[model samples]
Every structure is written in C-alpha cells, then in structure tokens.
Target: MTFRQKNKITVLGHDIKAGENCELSFGVANLHTSSSVDVPVIIERSKKPGPVVLFTAGIHGDEVNGVEIIRQIIAKGINKPKAGTIICIPIINVFGFINLNREFPDGRDLNRVFPGTKNGSLASRVAYKLVNEVIPDVDFIMDFHTGGAGRFNAPQIRIAKNNPKLDKLADVFGSPFVLYSKNIKKSFRNTCHKLDIPILLFEGGKSFHIDDQVTNTAVNGAKRVLNHLGMLSTRFKISKPKKMPVYILDSRWQRASFSGMFKPSIAINSKVTKGDVIGNITDPYGKFNHFVKASNSGYIINVNESPIVYQGDALFHITTKLK
Candidate 1:
C-alpha cells in the first residue's frame, strides 16, 4: 500500500503552519457494478514525536454526530498537538456513510466484524485493514458512535472494565456517565484490548442527524485526549476523573408488543423503578392504548425515538440501576 505525504495548514501555538499529514490507502475493492473503492486514512503527524492516538468515527456509518465532531476538530483552529500523530478516520464505513445507512452494503454490522480476515466478507476485509494497518500503530484508540436510527443515547463513555488506564481516559471526557463493558463478541474494542491497546468508546447523538451538544462534547473530549497523551502542550482542565463509573454487566432491550405510536414517559438517562410507567403505546385511530412499564429498576440508557414501532421491536435499553 502506497501513502502520499501532504502538508496541511494547522493552527499550532497561535500561528498557522504547514504540517505533514499522511493519506494512506488501506485496501481497494471492486464493486459488483464494476466500480472500485479505496479506504484511506488521514494522519496528522506533529513535528515533535509522541504517542499516536487514533480517533475514528462512522464505525456504524449512520452515526453522524461523531463524524461531524471529527470533521470539526480537524478544521477548527483550536489548540494543536505538539508531539506525535493523530489519525482521524472521520468516515470508516465509507459505503454505508454514502448511503446514510448503518450496515454495510453487504448487510453486515461492521462493529461485530473485527480483526478480520484477509479474504473474507466485506465487513471482515475492512476490519482486517483497520486492525492491521491502523490499530497496531496507535498508542491509544478512541472510537466514536451514536445511537442507531430509532434510538437516542445520552453522551457517555463505554470502557472495558479490566483496563484501568482506559477507564481513567474515559472520565477525562467529563461525560455525565460511563459504562464498564466487557469484551463484546467480535467487537473492535475486544480486538484492540486483546492486543493490549487501550480503546475508549464515546457514544452520543442519533443516526443520520447531528446533535450540536453531542458534537461539542466529543470535540472537547478528543482534545482532552490529545492533551492527556502529551501530543499537545495546552493544558485542558479536565474535570477530576470520576470514580470508576457505574457498571452495567448486562443490559436487555424491551421490545414493543404491538405496532403503534410510542409516547415515552421516560427520557434517556432517566432512572426508573420497577413497574414505573415508561411509555404508552397507542393507536393513532384513537381506539387502543397499551402502557409500557419498567420490568426492573435501572437507568434508561437508551430509548426508541422513531415515534412508531413494530411488534417485537426493541423499545428501551436499560442499564443496571445504581444503588
């Protein structure tokens, strides 16, 4: 794979200077329609060398807020890193990003296909490219995401519980809450951790739409990481790192029993008690109303926002309640 070196104008130390950022091609593929596609990376290498931290978004493609956040960071003339490199892949699943869809054109979830195979499915091939050409080079990795279509997730961090370093990194972002997650099946975080590479998951916003608050929060967090890694000289007054954030070892999705308009009584991040009325499923024809209640007491980490739902569709994602 060949890479081209380009000098990009960066605002560092209150002045604009041209710096080298890498444009490396990951892998190429031929679409069934006879067109070719290439996955490339944008790496900002500082004049002084320090730890390399990779910040990626669009792992799910539909997660737009993170993508916007990355874009803003690269474009905004704010504090610049003094040492090491910052690789920003604002759009990972390019095909999905183009189509404004969550899954790849091959109908696979890119997040669940990690450390992929050289010769495998589309998702696997891309995952392999990331793990080999990208992951191995970074000292730390931050993957950004947002709630999928039909759901809303508050700005939060998700870190693997075993890595104290990664856990500390999560709190530096100053989000309202953090979740201690385990190695999910075939997840990118799982693959990165297996290689002892610390990774943090920051999820916010909603798919196909940009939320200003989430974007700002993510931009601030990325800058803080740059500061934390010594890539930048400016001091970010990160709020004191929070105690190990509450953990949700397990979560379950509550699905709708019947299709109708969903009037949610609870908001994302709200705490609910067992049997609390969370929402009401009602008919637009004004004949039927079904109440939805919490089966267990916990934090409402996620809620459906699609307004309408189908039978058996997931409606709520409840994290274990904090005592």
Candidate 2:
C-alpha cells in the first residue's frame, strides 16, 4: 500500500510524510493593501495505501453546520483512517464565513462556479484551484451543506440519480431522507461528476446556528463510511437507526399565496397529507388571513424560519415519497 510505506507529500509548500497529519495554509486571495488571506486544509495520511477521501464545508460561508461537522471530526482525532488519506477543509469560503453571508464578496454564489478559472472572479479562482488541483486526486468526497435564507433541511442526503455507487454511499450515511438531484450546470457536484469522482452531499439544519440533531447525524455518517471502507474498525458494534432512510423521488416548494405574518402549524420533517394546513398567513393589522396547504402528501423537508414573507415567495419545501 502506498500509504503503508513512508512517502513524502508536499501541499501548499508544506511537506507531509505518510502516517502523519498536518494543517497547511492554502493561499486563496490577496487584498490591494498587501496581505493575503489563506485558508487552512488539514491532511491525514495512513501508512497503508488505500482510497483517498476528501471532506469539505463552508461553501456558503454562513452554513456553519457543515463547517462544525468537519471541525468536530478533526478535534476528536479519533479517525486515523488505517488505509487511506483524509483531507478536510473545515472552512472553504473564508469570505462568506467571516461575513455570515452565502456568496462571495463579489456577490457570486461560490457553489455555482466550479472547475474555476484563476483569472476569473474570486469565487471562480477558488473553485478552479480545488477542481484543477485538489478534486482530481481524491477517490471519494463527502461535501457538507446546510439550509440557507432561513430554510431548514430535514437531515437528508442529496445524491445523483442512476449511480449505484453514489446510492450505496448515501445509504451508508443513512439519513432519514435521501434526495436525488439532477445536475446543475456549474455546481461543484456537476464538476466532480465530470471528473468521475463520486461525491455525497449531506445537508441539514440551517445557516448560522448549529443544530445538534443534524450535526451529530453528519459526523456519525462519515464515520460509518470509514468503518465500511475498512479504514475505521467496525468492531464494538455501532448502533443503527431504528428505521431505514426514506427515498424521495420528487419535491416541490409550497409558495405563499399572499404576503403576511407567517405562522407555521407544523415543524421540520413532519408528515402531512394533501391539503394539510402547512401554515397560516395573517396580517397583523387587517382581517386578511390565508392558509397554506400541502399540494401532495409526504414529509416537510425544508421550511423558512423567517416569518415575514411576500406573495409568491417559497414558504415550504415539501417532499413526496417515491412510488
């Protein structure tokens, strides 16, 4: 195994040997004044050669749930994968993270630009660096994400369809909800697929505050994958969820019929039937009031936490079971 024997590796101008782990500051951007901001990526390699896996978070910056998930894994230091290399970038979009926003300083969505161009915008440059240099070398990827714009995801795994390998990987993570997404033109997932590297996306909670349920679920999911891959020992028997994951075939957002002070009747992940009152929209000063009902039956996957909404705004992201 390549990792089993001593080997030298250099990244960001830092040298790392097999069976070791270290943090390297990767240069991303520089301001006109003088200094540049470099992001930190932690690399861990095993003595035995195996698969190379990567975990990334903070693509949206305010989506700190994913960022925290990676941090906990690194802080615990329990996962010294016995076979392969694990590289983690707990915070990838330093600009978005520091600003508590979803996009780059230039207001471009980082996730929308992939296989980035160094000569392009800041988001483009960062994406280009990872796609050209970091992503091609990995065998597997587990990208973490969370809801944005006050939207909350019901702890789920979003994957690509028609790929058994991706399906199996998603199953291993074993979230309550498994969403199959068609490729978006410039998204990271699309770019990775083009490179033939399988990537699994785990999304839960909302941006900013860390939700305990979603955070813990994501951490365990990654460990489960390592155990399955023979990197982490499966001995001692890890507990499984009482129920299996629900596969979602289709989903839609329940938009507001009119603008008002929103009052939700249900919580995230709640089961509802067609015509169920998802919420009520009422005006504080006037007698105008309206109820939002489900168009079809299934689970309430994502909902906006913000009560103030306008007409035609998406108020609820509802999911339907696969036939």
Candidate 3:
C-alpha cells in the first residue's frame, strides 16, 4: 500500500520523469506475414510522486470485453492521474488478438507461461518481456479479463484469500462480487504475487463480446480505486456501488445433465435456492427436456451462454459459501 516517491521512472528502456506522459511500444514479434505488431503502453505521470498503478487487459485475445474496459479508461482520459503514474496496456496478447484466437500463434496459452525466458516460445517471450521489463517498477496491477468459451462471468474482483490489503482494495473496487480465487501456476497473477506486487484480477462478461453494464462496472470500480489512492483527477466523479459486494468464500459449477439446446432461466448475479430450476436442456428433436436445477442455494456468478451443450459441461457457477 506504500510507494516510494520516484522522481523518474524507466519503462521499456525509456526514461520518463515526473509530470510526463509517454506512449511506448512493446513490440515482441512479427506476424507470419512479417508485418510488425507493436503493443502500445500508454502512461501518464503526475507532478507529485505516488503509486504506480498498471491497468492491463486482453491477456487472452478473445477477451474483447476486457480490452474494451481499458479502451474506455484511456479514451475517457481516466488514465490521467492526479498523483502518481497510471500505465495502461489495453491489449497484451496481440498475436491472439490479431488472429481472433485465445492463445498465441504457436498455440501456447500466454497465461500459463509466466516469468518467461528470453529465448522461449512466442508467448513466453512476451511474458518474459512483461515480467522482466515492465513489472519490476509496478506498485500494483489491475488485470482485466472476461469469461472464456461461451461462458459469461458476472462482474467480479478476484483475489487470493486471507490478504487484508487485497481485501480492502477489493472492497474499494466495489464490484458486484469478490470471489476468493487462488493464483494459477505460471500465470501473471502468480508472478505478481511472488514479486510482492499486489494485483486484482477482474473477470466479467464473455469472450469476444462487450456488455455496457460490465464495462461500466469495471470502469467505475477502477475510478473508485484511483480515488481511494488519491490518484483520481478532480474532474471525474465517483459513484458508489448500489450495494456492497458479495464476498464468495467457495463456489462450484453446476454441470448440464443432458446434451442439447441449452438456455439459462436465471441471469448472472441472481440468487437462487436449492432445487430451483435455473436453466433447461432440450433435444433438437423435442423428444426430451431436462430442467437444470440448482445444486444449492447461492448466487449465480457465471452462466454458460452456449446454445448447444454437452452432458457434464459446466452450465452455471453457483456460490456455496459466503464470507
């Protein structure tokens, strides 16, 4: 929660002093066509020295909703802080983004390769550059993400359990839900945690889709966090969340009982009771219809939006315990 007062900071080998704004290129590799791909890193610093907060999204190329959140943050000038430095990397997996795919061109999941080696795979090289060149000077990070594979996640802030500092920060972010999640091995969140850099992983909406409600929720949360840190500009107004976030201690996915056309009757963030019919599965031939009942009484944090689902596929993510 504390940051050393820095007069000058270097990012991507470029030195930027206080009260300066810079846009640096994080070009990792070229496309198969040999075209250049440069990831833009937008930065803004204040005259006063304070914390350096990094806002990142598009770790998975298909998670366009996350990219949109960062896009709005920059387009609305929200990245211009009143104190400290605000760094925005709206898209990270440019290769996947370019191909409209989730993984890098070489089929490696970028999130799985962290603290990478210099002479590794394409995804690993990007991860290496990010962990080595960028993360060293970061005080905190807010990594945006969206649900994958036709699943829609409710807007939520995810963090490891039992960190008071992260808990307070998550409260300040004020999303609809705060789900306690463990960091994945070799993931960006895990690397940051190992480096002692606190981070909040935000998951919302669905891949390749953008919802206004989800975007607004994340943007507002970011603004609130900036305000809490005394980095928000006076020109921006912060709105309080309608209700306090639900702290989810444990959750489970309710899988589909039958494979067929699927439709969710309950929406994300909706609370349900045990045995409630939250969704249904039906065959295309109208021979059978199966009502998907809730496994237990809890909030629906994620819903599978895919029309056709298979048996044992995750249909709904329901909370099991609350803090």
Residues 113-218 of candidate 3 have per-residue lDDT tens digits of: 9988899999999999998888778899999999999999999999999899999999999999999999999999999999999999999999989999999999
Evaluated at residue 166, the lDDT of candidate 1 is 68
lDDT value for model 2: 0.82
Ranking by TM-score: 3, 2, 1
Predicted structure with the largest TM-score when compared to the true one: 3
The residue-by-residue lDDT of candidate 2 on 1-323, one tens digit each, is 12223365555556677788887886778755567877888888888777778899999999999999999888876356787778888888888887788999889998898878989999999998888767555778889999888888889998878998888887888888889888788998889899888889899999987999998888888888877776764442455754677888889998888888987889888889999888889998879878888888888999888889999888888886572
Against the true structure, candidate 3 has what lDDT? 0.94
TM-score for candidate 1, please give it: 0.84
Candidate 2 vs candidate 3: which has greater lDDT?
3
Compared with the true structure, model 3 gives a TM-score of 0.99
lDDT of 1: 0.75
TM-score of each: 0.84, 0.92, 0.99
Lowest lDDT sum, 10 consecutive residues, model 1, at: 8-17
Full-model lDDT for every candidate = 0.75, 0.82, 0.94
If ranked by lDDT, best first, what sequence of candidates would result? 3, 2, 1
Question: For model 1, how does the per-residue alpha-carbon lDDT over 237-302 read when each residue is reduced to its tens digit?
Answer: 443433434555666788898999998888887878889999999999999999999988888888
